[model samples]
Target: MLDHEVNRFNGIEIEAAHAPEDPECFAGELAAALAAWEEAGRELVWLRVPIERAALIPVATAAGFRFHHSQEDYVMLVRRLRPDALVPHYATHYIGAGGVVLNSRGELLVVSERHRRSARPYYKLPGGALHPGEHLVDAVIREVREETGVHARFEALVCFRHWHGYRYGKSDIYFICRLTALSDEIIRDEREIEECLWMP
Candidate 1:
């Protein structure tokens, strides 16, 4: 539990509890905390519960807590105790783009980074994060060229995913795009890309 005197809020952080436990135990504690906070004239009560603790969600909701937002491993819930308190809303913060380029011979364009921090090297699609003020279509086209040294035409947006618990500790907007290659020749960014390949 943390006390934010500056914000006039009491924050309760709940970790995952193993099963075969009682939800009533947590509910009782939450009830007591709510009563105390109400009596103290606090503006808000914040509860951070990890997604793994699926069991605690109902207990919190039953106490009038509303979903705020999720980051990394925790989902934040809040209960407003004051009418004048301000609450923040969600916004899109990051954009990541990649392309799935296939050749006439039914091969896919893939690349491996030189400085990957993982235990094993994993090949990825030929694309990356967008530059400042860059459009999504332009970003995908530029990334494919930079990583594979091949010119590609953006066809359509294949799919996109929202990544939480990412390495950078921020939400990521990952866009998977479909593109057609203009050339067979492969040139790679030596500083970022280690190898480029056309895999079946």
Candidate 2:
């Protein structure tokens, strides 16, 4: 078992604990330490536990803590020090390059990449690379409009996957799913896009 203290961006002090061998035992200790921190005027307590060793979840819930979000190697849970006056901080990260999946009815909108000389043709979603200093959402909207000629609004973040190859410079990629209303109007730009259509 190990413990550490850290400060959040909102100035709240957090106490975190981890146990490699016995998660149940560490959960009890973590609850106790969190109570102590709360008594000392800390605003919240953060916890990290492996998804496989999820026995700590019940203990934390019994101690009034709730699950937050999980990313990479950490799963964070928190208990608010000020129950009625809690305000969460929103931190946005650019999702590198962005692409959109437009689901209309039961079909997905896709674009056909034109064959250059003797190269093979390929199919892909309508989106493109992000410009410098552009947010992921804004970049996605711009790319979709530029490629497909349809205005769009962001609905939800569905899934992300990486694309790796020599042509793309072996960079990590992010595929974003967005829901937008469909229209019959077609806007085609010859330079960057070849053709667009809806397919199952």
Which predicted model would earn the best TM-score? 1
Give all candidates' CA lDDT scores: 0.78, 0.63
> What would the TM-scores of all predictions be?
0.55, 0.44
What global local distance difference test value does model 2 have?
Answer: 0.63
In model 2, state the lDDT of residue 52.
69
TM-score for candidate 1: 0.55
In terms of lDDT, the best-performing candidate is 1
Q: Candidate 2 residues 6-74, lDDT tens each?
A: 575332433333353465776667667766666767676666666665666677678777777666755
Clashing pairs in 2: none
The C-alpha local distance difference test score for the whole of candidate 1 amounts to 0.78
Clashing residue pairs in candidate 1 are: none
Q: Which stretches of candidate 2 lie over 4 Å from their true place?
A: 1-105, 115-118, 163-170
